[model samples]
Target chain A: MKHNSYFDGKVQSLELHTENGVATVGVITPGQYTFGTSTQEKMVITAGSLRVKLPDQDWQTVMSGEFFVVDKNVSFVVEAEQDVAYLCYYF
Target chain B: MKHNSYFDGKVQSLELHTENGVATVGVITPGQYTFGTSTQEKMVITAGSLRVKLPDQDWQTVMSGEFFVVDKNVSFVVEAEQDVAYLCYYF
Candidate 1:
């Protein structure tokens, strides 16, 4: 297990092995952020929500229990009004 | 946010704020452990499952998307056969 911190500890993640494959459970503090992905990521909102802007798309709210996918080798944007918890699976 | 490690890091948690109150997201390795709570806890399984024995009750399985509540000032037992991720809300 590994714990990774990003954006000066405002965002942190714990790596774990899941039935679906390698995944991370992370928390993001209230702020706006842009993330780049190496693998295609399936971002599942476990608690709270994320306002996301995918490539060539409009901003959308992804609520708890909902998910959004990000393609590999692209940078995407996310905004959080409050602390958000998510589980991301890389494929 | 604080990251708390327990059981020699076999169980670790990251603290966060949520609409429900103060909460933590954590991961547990494959093992059995007992925990004592100071506050009433709402334990939600985010990934995998927990074999839990609440106080005097028999062991039962708590699957993902399912939750179990533990009373304050009590000790409970939980066993994981694989890596399990969960969110615990304290009230």
Candidate 2:
């Protein structure tokens, strides 16, 4: 797994994988972003804050210990503005 | 996201998603099993104990705060026997 940090060191892609059938975990900081395209994805916010934006202009804010799922082909953006962290897996 | 628990009353699939472009998280427990097929998958153990079994008869044990990824076309199994928990996401 690969962990990458971004956004002037405020965000991170804590884990990245090239595998197709495994589970991985990561941590994100405040003002971080997890970008998605026409593909499907799933995620959960284990701690802190998170913002999810959908193509239909619908968005949501999640705080510590909250969970959400984004369906396929829905381009979206996830961001944290206040010391947030989350865990994700790809299947 | 959906959260489910199973076991000899001891395992759980904390979260499940049908989406392809988002991230989700879940928790697992002791003596729990996460089974995979020939497809690719990724996972991380945020807390507690975890055991992973590969198709080629390879396996590994993970403890609190450890992470790992599984590649495509590789079937595997994950089991915990003593009070374990984890967080996962799909992308």
Q: How does residue A77 of candidate 2 score in lDDT?
A: 77
Query: What TM-score, to 2 decimals, does candidate 1 have?
Result: 0.98
lDDT of 2 at A48: 57
What is the model-wide C-alpha lDDT for candidate 2? 0.54
Q: Which residue pairs does candidate 1 place in steric collision?
A: none
Candidate 1 per-residue lDDT, tens place, B1-91, comes to: 7999999999988888998999999999899999999999999999999999999899999999999999999999999999999999999
True contacts kept of each: 0.43, 0.00
- Model 1 misplaced stretches (Cα beyond 4 Å): none
- Model 2 misplaced regions, further than 4 Å: A16-21, A32-34, B1-91
Q: Give lDDT tens digits, candidate 2, residues B14-73.
A: 233222423334444445465653445556566556788866667888766676677765
Model 2, chain B: what is the TM-score?
A: 0.63
Q: TM-scores of the first chain across all predictions?
A: 0.97, 0.65
Residue A84 deviation, candidate 2, in Å?
1.4
RMSD of 2: 14.7
Which of the numbered candidates is closest to the native, going by highest DockQ? 1
